[model samples]
Target chain A: MTAGPVLKGAADRVLAAPAAPRRKGHPGAYLRWLLLFAGGLIMVAPLVWMLSASFKFSYELYDLNLIPVEPTLRNYEKVLGDPRFLRWFGNSFLIATIVTMSNLFFDSLVGYTLCKFRFPGRTLIFIAILSTLMIPTEMLVIPWYVMSQKFGWLDSYWGIMFPGMMTAFGTFLMKQFFESVPDDFLEAARIDGLNEFQIWWSVAMPLVRPALAALAIFVFLGNWTAFLWPLIVTNSVEMYTIPVGLKTFAVEQNVDWEMVMTGAAIATLPTLVIFLIFQRFIIRGVVMAGLKG
Target chain B: MADLALHGLTKTFGKTKVLHGIDLAVQDGEFVVFVGPSGCGKSTTLRIIAGLEDATAGTVEIGGRVVNNLEPKDRDIAMVFQNYALYPHMTVRKNIGFGLRTSRLSRAEKAARIAEVAGVLGMTDLLDRRPSQLSGGQRQRVAIGRAMVRDPKVFLFDEPLSNLDAQLRTQMRLEIKKLHKQVGTTIIFVTHDQVEAMTLADRIVIMKDGVIQQVGTPSEVFNAPANVFVARFIGAPAMNLLPGSWREGGVALDMGGQIALPGRQLADGTRVDLGIRPTDLAISADGAGQITGAITLVEPLGAESMLYIDAGGVEIIAACPGRTAPDPGQQIRLSADPEALHLFDATTGEALR
Candidate 1:
């Protein structure tokens, strides 16, 4: 008796070797890299120009050159010698720090409550918060100005800091991140004998560190460069933040290109420091939120 | 250690009742397991005892004190969740010691206790590793170690071993049993696997839908199941049931045979379903047995082979020696002792004593 031809054919087919691998690096891949590089250069050109102008003499300001022929520190000296420049820097740092801290505390607390706790009107409250996100910041400025004036908060740090103390976007981000921290962890923490606030502070909060870092860095940068509201609200140079003060300095000096560029270059330092400190968290948070969305 | 009791416990989630008035009393230091299929409310009952969930009605007593209103932290209980819920940011040692952060124990005492638990779980070398760095079984051990570090009045395990692979599940089941012996703490475990329930439980609580069908020792539940569901559920390969009607001294099987039940006093013509375990039916050599049928298929399980026999239109499974199982299409005679037969009501599916 012989093994059948059909069985032999199937065995031969099953034992056959695999096909060759595909080649790498097609033309479309090179095109994509070229396009991305061009887009990056376009985005970074203005920053390079500003740094170069700050170093060059005022005669070379309009040369369209990225690198300075003879870099000088005189513009920095003139900008720093102005006492009000330091005061404005201090004010901006103080308000940004306070606002970021407030947002971190209030936003995460509200987010935790909204996400973890089951109660009546939760969806309604969340919708209300979400609705506020649709309204532009320009539209809220008037109402905020009226409320600040009614409460005698004009020309004060509180007036500028209150609008951003707890943002709808931050709350939404925190809530989304909190969704990833399982209810099992919270229940286990409870069974482990931690109170509700402690559980939120220790167990829930630590798990959303990425979101918190993203929110902190975002809020700090937003407030650091804030101009419209602060300019409108503060009547004295003593109370002005960096952006408002720099605008006034430019106008007073009749657009001294070197001086203005020097101040702008120096003003970018804190934000650069912040980005360096939390760059990884920001990227991860964006990817996480993007995937979730 | 504490004796826990639930009096008329029920849970409702937005009008869908998950537990229907569960009432059970567990002795101090006893190991009780709740076994049921998914969505059967076994885990809900366990959570209510742990104070992770609030019962819709009734009170939970821990060591004779009502804990219905207490928070989970104040309930003096600990739970091992199914996913092992270890904090990803913390080391195994830190995860175990997290429960002691609010304790009145001195820092040194807490460290000593965590070290002791790690030693008990044979995980001292893995203590510095995070949960993300550990394997499934190792993470399960860390979860158990975390619960052990607390030394609470009662330990609630909600399908803790379900996450492990088959071999690891058996190993962890034995480890849990050994841990229970060493600590002698009151434990309430929940699982869907009947084998886990049978091997590790002092008393198994069998549940269906939202109600407990029976509560008994492993031997008792296996020997005399409370209903047809339990009869089919507790054994491997399940008990084979044949629909039939009862006569005074015998059951007229729906497939055309009579089984003489010598001691039953069932009413004549009562509709019933007769059940017999595959292991209880043996092949007869002389071809004169209570039932005879043609073999349809044979399943080899190493030591024993299961023969699927078709008698009339009904298919029945019987276990025979693996080396000597008759080939398919052969006629075989199988005999079962009368005492081994179980009779259940055809309509209600409840067993008839």
Candidate 2:
């Protein structure tokens, strides 16, 4: 008997020959490209605006104009010529550098301890340290301020740098990263006659460079852009960081819009440069930490 | 090379006991394999030997010296992990030379030793590549190479081949055997796979529930198991057990059948288990056999066929050669060779003869 109509119909669909399109489809493809272009523009508009404002003259800022009417180097000149601006920039650079390096070294120290060593109260210590991450900085602000005053640290660089140096989040991030590493690696190194310090320094540290870099970027960015803490502690203009100094420039009477934007632009540059350099490591570390946690 | 011994070894984690008074000895240049199911303390025993774990109450001796307080590095033993823990950041050459470099060895000597190990492991071409760049087998080879560079007195392998595919595992198993022959270092291997234990071990130690059930040569363990746990564990298509009792002149099966016994003189009314290997079961066409069975399932494996038969109220497996694909639901008579049969006391699970 011949095959049924249903089976024959399925066979015909399965074995159908290729056919040319009845209508042109280029418009749909172009429309998709247009939507993508619009999305890109929307995401990049703020950055373009910031760059444009950084170059505009003081009179051109209030015109609500996208393009600068008079793009001059006068704002940059004013910002660079101010001695306070240079001092603030130097202070910010030094603090961020110190905090970043200390965090990288010290957090890994504690991270490796928590990860490998089986000391008494290890879990308790880890939980205590990790709990610090949940406490908001704002909640601790008053107590920290009073403590800094008691230490006679207000208006000093230590008041700002010391508190920002060691962070619970950095230690937590590093501990999680170190835990993902196989225990055998450490045991193998130990069997190689390497001491505990040597294992942490040579083997564990090298393997965790990516995580360290990500943490460095995070700490540096946080320290560089820190406003509230620095603002509270630094009363003198000499010890002011860029963020605090920028606020001073904006609040002064007859504020130069161009100069303020230049100061803001300068403050944003270091973070941008750091992020651009270590963006891949930053993304990888974030994804790894997310997966591990 | 050196011999090692464990004396009254025992371990406990909090309230739970893991290893219960285990004692063993390994001669120099001999390979001992610990085979058991998971949570049987085989890996724990190996770790204790490696000084990676502290035994609760035991003394471990390596090279005739007690190493209970010694660190792993001081124990003079090298271990190859199941995960092949090669340092992912370092190249193969550096990974092999790390231990030497950390010691008092000079730079030149370290390089020479690395080169020698690379040559031995056939890893000269992969020396410049990192661990992440190598395949699983290559990484395992690098791990072995790292252990070789140490030239320790004893080597411990914790299921090193469990991570590889079946084909690669067999090839690596043979390589490890050859390596043992060449190096002549005492080796302690841990694996749950009976095939691996059977193939590579000079002596196999079988364990159950953290206790050493038996230790003997491969043939001894296979031919004469110490207990029912071992008899059931050592062989494939496990030994068949028939419930029976000693009668006046023979053993009577629960199904009202009887097999004539020699003058062994088992106590009357003693409960016993008759054990027989599948290969010992002969197919007979005559109805005069001791047991009759119906073939319920047949698995033809080209070289040999396995028949699952229902006989004497128990299902039994019979291995037959020569492509004999018996049809399902067919009647068959099975009788064990009188000389090949095994007798065991039912209560103690110990061999009767």
Candidate 3:
């Protein structure tokens, strides 16, 4: 007997010839792309406007025009010629560099400890450090101020830089990455006659590059753009980081909008360059840490 | 080359005791394979011997010196990890040379040793490549090369071939045996695959439930299994056991059968299990035999066929010629030579001659 109609129909579909346009059935596909494009443009428009304002005359700041009618180098020249601006730039560079180096060293040490070592209360210690990530920086400012006052560190670089030289999020990120390195390698390293510290430096550290890059970028950016703590702790212009110094454009009577925009624009260059250089590592680190860790 | 010995080795994690007390000895240059199921403490025993894990009680001796308190490097042994454990950032040359970092050898000597190891592994052309660039077998060879480069007194392999595919595993298994012969270092290898243990080991140490059941050469274990566990565990498809009790003339099987005992004897009315391999239980050419059953199923393995027959109350496995594959529901009479049967004390699961 011949096969039923439904079976024959299924067989025909299963054995159909190749090279045919398969299917497309979703609705509003082009509209989704359009809406996404609009959302991205909205997010990027402020930066574009800040760049445009950096090159504009003070009178052109209020308008919605992206390209200034009179784009001039006068504001840039003013920003570059001021020794106060150069000092603020140097302050930001030094503080960010110091904080990044310290965070990379201390956070990785703490992370390797929590990940590999079998010390008692390891999980408790890790939880304690990670719980610090939940504490809002705004809430910790009073205690920090009291401590700084007791240490006579107000208006100094120490008060502004000490609170953020190491972080909990960095330790957590590094621990997540270090867990993927095999325990066998560490045992092998021990048999090879390297001490624990040397093993951490030579064998374990090289395997977690993505986390290092992510942590370095994070620590550098966090310190460079710290406005509230730096503003509260430092009164003099000599110790003001870039973010705190950018606020100095607000004088008592009126604000110099062109100079502020110029400073803010210049302050953003290093972060943008860092992001561009390590874009692959940052994206892959976030993806790997989120999905696997 | 050195002798390795474990004396009264016992391990306990908190209140859970893993290894009760294990004592074993290995001759110099002997390839000893620890074969067991997972959680049988074979890996733990090996780790204790390597000094990676401190024994809770007992002493490990290498070259007749107590090494229980010594560090792994101080104990003069090297291990090939199951995952190969090569540093992903380093080339094969650097990875192999990493073990010599603390050695007092000159740079030229370290280079020569690394090159010699790479030559032995036949991976000299691939020395510059990272582990990520090599195949699974090549990574295994690099691990072995790193172990061999040290020329240590002993080598510990922790299931090093468990990661490869079937065909690659076979190929690597042969190469590892040849490497063992060439170097002649005392190697303690651990694997769960009995075929690997049988083919590669000079002596196989079989373990179960954190205890060694038997230790013998392949022929000894195959010919005379110490107990039921070893009897069933050493061979494929396992040995078939038919429970029976003693009779006046011979051992009367549980269901309505009796097989003559040629030379072995047991007390009357004693309960026992008759252990017979599938190959020894022949399907009789004539229809009549001691045990008559109908073929319930057949497995065609090309070279031989396995028959599952119900010989009264119990179902059993028997083998037949491949080309004469039996059909299901066909009547069959199965029997084994009296000399080929293994009788075990049914209660203790111990062999009875």
Candidate 4:
């Protein structure tokens, strides 16, 4: 009460007023909402079809309706009942988890080094690493295969993960984020009696959490849904990841499309959850990366 | 805790030399201030002493041992940066105790040390807050506390108060001086603000163009500057320097006045500059003064006023009593005691006697 007048100043009142109402009354707003809703339907149609198909029987596959009239749990039953399906799911989980962990650790370490340390040829080395991003993955797939064969890593977890253990894109992302950490903080840490590694780990790393979270989500989702490298290197049924294992549903003569859709629907869950949880970071990280570049 | 000395300290970034052979000896528990204009290498000299930067050629000795090749941590020093550099993600308590991460102190001892420092800095309640939540002054206190917790041989402050507003800067300046008094640790503070240098230093090292111009106590530098640059830099409103040539009984001013040098004799045509503080120059109502000038501007400061006068072709600033200052366009005679004048060699700019 003592400071009531001051607290209720005209400027404060103006600022405390509610944000402008949504422009729903305008024709432009109506057009924008209509267009956005149409685009949303187009993007989500395939996902809706997949979900719809997962509930239908093989005979009902040709139906164009989004909701099946004869929906049954039999497709899920057949997909879950198979032992090989579970093995493939587990394999994908293991490979994706390991690959994501390795990328996060090695990429951030190399990024911190390339960004913070001063040494001869540092710029050249960073350039060399970044130059790899220019090379097409298809061009290097044969070499990756040859290297895996030479190391006897074919049909193994290491073969699927070796190429992605560290990536140029991840390194570039981490370095761009590390650039925001002040050199003064590092100097203060050094004067505080911290070694270079300690400074990087404690002071430098914590400051770029948003970048790290964004990187983690990107790597995790990329590996989780990865098809090309995993499909190429892995040979045996036991080693096939979800994407490769899902292919087994389509035989030479008869393609079990319903079962395939069921597996895909289940595989989509983890990535969807992850994306939902960290959607804001992804948007922020992308905008920041574009601005910084 | 340590007397520090720099011998032939020099730094070069590629072809540009930043610090050129800086030499000074700081006594144990002495508070020394490095004051200079920007690009004058005051911060660079501080960085080299803290070992954050490598001197191109010099040896830094702390407590009589060369620490040229030692890491900053190994050099037994702590630095407070201009940006504070407090870890944004860490709480104030953690930020202050960070230096102790490498110390062998027990957990309880480290906490106690942090608590004591926080108490001294009056940041006990704010210890749980992050730097983002703190005001500018509080963040500065956290930075000082972080440096204090180390209790190293010397404390290095690189223009630590430059980021604060004018009011906060003065308050923090007093706190830092009182802190030095209580802790009695050797401190090397770098600032371009002359007031900070004058009010806080036991000895002020004034530098220009990467070279130390004068190193002396506040009073010594204010009263008897080593050179023309020091004379102008150490005081507010700057000292008035007039170009002239030596004559028989005195120096004849180039702007139409002659100031007598009673007992000294010099070459008749030697070029010299006569320096006088604004405080020493007074307006003469009787028209019997060394130089006469028309007042162009009057800036009052409550108790005193600064008069910008045009004496012939030269501009001079004189301090006058605020209430007694005459209006602009009034012609006035300015006078100063011959004993209070400073004479510098015009060519070299070095003080003579």
Among the numbered candidates, top TM-score falls to: 4
lDDT of 4 by residue, B1-353 (tens): 99999999999999999999999999999999999999999999999989888999999999999999999999999999998998888889999999999999999999999999999999999999988789999999999999999889999999999999999999999999999999999999999999999999999999999999999999999999999999999999899999999998688999988999888777899999999999999887685889899999999998999999999989999999999989999999989988889999999999988
lDDT of 2 by residue, B162-247 (tens): 99999999989998999999889999999999989999999999999999999999998888888888888888888888889999
- What order do candidates take by lDDT, descending? 4, 1, 3, 2
Candidate 4 lDDT score at position B210: 96
> Candidate 1, which CAPRI tier?
acceptable
> Per-model C-alpha lDDT, please?
0.88, 0.85, 0.87, 0.90
| TM-score per model over all chains | 0.92, 0.89, 0.92, 0.93
Model 2 misplaced stretches (Cα beyond 4 Å): A1-49, A149-156, A288-293, B248-250, B261-263
Instruction: Tell me the interface RMSD of model 3, in angstroms.
Output: 16.5
Model 2 local distance difference test score: 0.85
- Model 1, span B1-353: residue lDDT tens: 99999999999999899999898999999999999989999999998888888899989999999999998888889899998888877889999999898899999999999999999999999999988789999999999888999899999999999888999999999999999999999999999999999999999999988899999999988889989999999988899899988876989988887889998888888999999999999998774687889999999998999999998888999999999888999998888889899889989989899
lDDT of 2 by residue, A1-293 (tens): 00122223332343343234434568886787799999999988866676778888866787778778777777888899999999999999999999899999999899889888998999999899889888888888788899999999999888988887788888887887787667887888888788889989988887777788889999999999898889988899999999899888778897766676788887888788989999876775666556556
Q: What does candidate 3's lDDT look like per residue over B70-179, in tens digits?
A: 88889899999998889888899999999999899999999999999999999999999988789999999999998888899999999999999999999999999999
Better of 2 and 3 by TM-score: 3
lDDT score, candidate 4: 0.90
Greater-TM-score candidate between 2 and 4: 4
Cα lDDT, model 4, residue B140: 95
lDDT of 4 by residue, A157-180 (tens): 999999999999889888877776
Docking class of 4: acceptable
Candidate 1 wrong stretches, greater than 4 Å = A1-38
| Fnat of model 2, as a fraction | 0.52
User: Roughly what TM-score does model 1 have, to 2 decimal places?
Assistant: 0.92
